[model samples]
Target chain A: MQRYKGIVAYDGSGFSGYQIQPNGRTVQEEIEKALGKMHKGKPVSIVASGRTDAGVHAKRQVIHFDSALQLPSERWVKAVNGLLPGDISVMQVDAVSSDFHARFDASGKTYKYVVYTGSIRDPFKRHYAAHYPYKIDIAKVKKASEFLTGTHDFTSFCSAKTEMEKKVRTVTNISIEQNTDEIVFTFTGNGFLYNMVRIMVGTMLDVGTGKIELQTIPSILTGRDRTLAGKTAPAEGLYLWEVYY
Target chain B: MQRYKGIVAYDGSGFSGYQIQPNGRTVQEEIEKALGKMHKGKPVSIVASGRTDAGVHAKRQVIHFDSALQLPSERWVKAVNGLLPGDISVMQVDAVSSDFHARFDASGKTYKYVVYTGSIRDPFKRHYAAHYPYKIDIAKVKKASEFLTGTHDFTSFCSAKTEMEKKVRTVTNISIEQNTDEIVFTFTGNGFLYNMVRIMVGTMLDVGTGKIELQTIPSILTGRDRTLAGKTAPAEGLYLWEVYY
Candidate 1:
């Protein structure tokens, strides 16, 4: 058996999430189905670096799958892309060691959340960005982002139904950047809990809008209650930027 | 009466381009309908810098309209934005002289056509760019762009159904740039004939793909027949970049 690693990019608008679900379509199921057809009806299963929720996009998502056929790297890239829908593309494919797993071998991951804070909505950017018409204090948001960084138990920032036994995760880097009319929040971490990044972005927005104080971040983490945090931002504005090993 | 000039942007995936068409919804019609509602049932007509064909996008399209009510600039911006659909946006609004006309007073217009030349389709960019799964000779396209620059009678580039009496147009600049996997064609001209920009891009692509030699450009222009030129490119990839007066 040959293990192939692929880098993928997708528009998550039509997906129910990364993992398979009974109610709606998923990126994994679509890719697996396409792969199965390419492998002569042989079913194939893929493991991803991380699972992204519905309406979230990905610029570069890593995945691994084992196939009995020894196909060339270029053939794997082209064959899978030809069968997949227009919203999904395999950017690169390479043969990796059999033991190199996509999810298990990953050291860290990066995500970006885009917010369009202009007074007027930009129709061209509507699907790619979250529109917030309220004026925000950038300084406060920056301060709050610093407080959220470093190792901590991020229970407040995670969804309440998270199945992970340990709520502690290390956020290595956090950045808040403002361009002409957009605000971007970038986070890099060892791992993320369910809905952690979205909740963190929401809480930071609350700080920028003066709904919450900058000093409240530490206490929010200590509270370990999802309700103590701000509302989770919509999934459309979030993107899986990259996966690092 | 006060004349207001506004800069607009739109994702043309939803509308029938910038002109008002009888059979389909148009960017102009939508904005005008919203303006009429704001003016208490009085219909308003807006004149744009130029007419864009169906499915063409715009980054900055200039337009002018007359209104009897002395509405504050902010209120006008907010009211129109409040009623317009998410596909179109009014980026800026300013008071202009009554003599100012968006079409007749325009000195130059710029357009950009984006082509994704990679083998795989980019799902996120499906509606925004043209996907050409073929290898192109970038050097030949760049040389052909140079040949297209300068004042000339672009009769062959104009669509056969164009209503203009004179096909003489001044192409001030033509630039073909390739960045990684995408090719961008930018053109600046005194004015473009109906479907002229799309035809130019198509002709250039033919040269880049070696379907037609670079030397064929002058002959295509001299022939003065639309059939001599290459096929007209699709409208989805074309963007009205800006207008200068």
Candidate 2:
């Protein structure tokens, strides 16, 4: 069997999430179905680098699958893309060793959350950006983001129903960039818990809006309670930027 | 009566076009309905700088409407935006002179046509851009574009159904820009005839693909027949970029 790795980009508006779901559609199921068609009805299972929630977009997502059938790399890319919907695209495909896994072998991941802070609404960019019409204090958000970087217990930043026992995760980098009319928060980490990035973005938004102080970040982390942090931002503004190995 | 000029932007994928049509929804009808709702059942008529065909988007479209009842600029901007669908937005609203008009008072108009010439598809930008997925000769298209710059009778470049008696229009500037994976054709003119920009883009595509020679542009213009020019490009790739006073 040959192992194949591919990078995908998708508009997650119509998807339930990255994982397979029973009732609603998911990105994983759609790709698998396309792959089955290309492989002459042979079912193929794919493992993704990370699972993004419903309404979250992906600029570049990595996935790996194994198959006995040998196909040219270009043909594989075209065949899979031809069967998929217009909202999903296979950006790149490559042959990899069997030991290379998309999820388990990944070293780190990066995500970007875009917030449109302009008073005027942007019709074309509405789906990809979160509209927050209020004025933001950039200095506070910048100071707060420094506290979020490095290794820490991120239980306060994750959803309460996380299944993992270990709530500690290493956030290698966290940066807040403010443009003329938009605020972008980029997070790089070894791994992320359920809703961790969204919750962190929400808490930073609160800091920028003066609802939370910069010094409260350490207290929030120590509390180890989801309620101690700000509300989780909506999923539409989040994008899976890249996966590193 | 006060004449208010507003700059609008819309994603044309959902509308029949800028003009009001008997069948299907139109952008003009939707905005008029929103205005009536905001004006306590009184209907308002809006005149736009130019009429865009079905599925043609607009980044900045200038329009004007007259109303005897005084309304604040912010109220006009906010109320129309609140009532319009998510695809449409009123970018700016300003009170104008009573004699001001949207169509007749315009000195120039600009349109941009984007063609994606990449092997891989872009899922996020599918609706906003046209995909060609073909190798193009940029030098040939650029040479053909220079020939189409000056004033000429644009009968061949316009649709046969156009009813204008005078087919002569001056093209002030015509330039082709090649980005990393996309080719953008921008045209600035006194005005454009029916399907003029699309036909020009299509003719340029033909030149880019070596289907037609660079010298054919002058002959096509001299032919004064629509069949002599290239096919009409899809409307989704065209955007009414701006209108100059």
Candidate 3:
């Protein structure tokens, strides 16, 4: 058996999440189904770099799977994409060492949260961004993001429901980018907790709108309390932009 | 009663064109229904800059209507937008002279046709662009476009069904702009005949692909025959970008 590595891109609008659930359609389930069909009804399993919440898009999600069927790497890319849904495509495929694990390999990840400040929802951008419909001070948002960079216990930015007890994560960098109709916040880190990026974005937006002070982020991180931070931003605005391996 | 002028924007994917049709849902029908509902079943009429074919989008389509209800321009914008569907919106509203006509008073218009040049369809841009999965030489497109600018009979570029005897129109400018994943062709002209832009784009794309010679453009324009040009480009790629008064 040979292991294959592939890069996946998905719209995420119709998917429940990346992982397979008992009752809902998901990104993982769709790809596995496609692989099984390619192998003539034999079951296929895949391991992904990580899970993305419902409505969260991904530009390049890494995945790995082992198969006994022999096919050229380029053929594997074409054959699997043809069997998959329109919203998901295998961007690239290659053979890899059996020891190379998609999730366990050393790497970092980057995410972007897009927010539109327009009063009325833009027809073209409604599906792509989170509409805030409020005044935001860009200076405040940039200042708040500075405090989030570096190693820290990100309990204040993580989802309360996650079973993981370790909340420490390293944030390599953070940036707030301004566009004509939207402001995007990009976060790069070694790892992220559940809902961590969205929570951090919501907290920064609160700072921008003066709901939370610029100085509030440092203290919130120090306190290690989820309730001390701002709301969890909507999942639709989040994108798993890249994963490094 | 006062005459009101407005600039409308729509996504066009859910529309059956801008005109009122008996069968399919049209953009005009939706706005008229909204106006009728606002006026308590009193039918309200609207005149547009021009009719866009089914699946064609608009960025600033000019329109005018008379209203017995007096409200501030801002309120009119909000109330109309609230009543309209998510795909359509009144981007701007203003008071205009009673003699002002959206179609007759217009001097020129600008249209943009977008074509994506990628092997795989971009899921995010599927609704917004036309997928052309072929190699297009940029230099050939630009050279062909240069001959299309300026005044011409334009009978070769127009649809065959138009009853108007005068096929002569002045094209002020034509530009081929290149983007990373898409190529946009912008046209500015005093007026256009039915399907004029799409037919022209099809002809130019053919020239770009080497199916037609660059020197043939002049003879085709001189022929002034609909059959002399290339196929009609798809409607979804066409956008009425701006209406000039």
Strongest candidate by lDDT: 2
DockQ of the candidate models in sequence: 0.66, 0.83, 0.45
What TM-score is obtained by chain A of candidate 3?
Answer: 0.97
Looking only at chain B, model 2 earns a TM-score of 0.97
Candidate 2, B1-245: lDDT as tens digits: 78999999998978888999889889899989998887898999999998888889999999999887677777778888999998899988888999999999999999999998888889987887788888899999989989999899999999999999999999999888999989999999999999999999999999999888888899999999999999898898999999999
- Estimate TM-scores for all models: 0.90, 0.95, 0.92
Per model, the share of native interface contacts recovered reads 0.89, 0.86, 0.33
Indicate which candidate wins on TM-score: 2
TM-score for model 2?
0.95
lDDT of 3 by residue, A39-84 (tens): 8899999999999988999888999999987777678877998899
- The best candidate by DockQ is 2
Runs of candidate 2 exceeding 4 Å displacement: none
Docking class of 1: medium
Candidate 2 per-residue lDDT over residues A89-206, each given as its tens digit: 9988888999999999989999999999989888877888888888788898888889999899999999999989999999999888889999999999999999999999899989
Worst 10 residues of 1 chain B by lDDT: B69-78
Model 2 error, position A55 (Å): 1.7
| Cand. 2 Cα-lDDT | 0.91
Ordered list by DockQ, greatest first? 2, 1, 3
Q: lDDT (0-100) at residue A218 of candidate 2?
A: 94
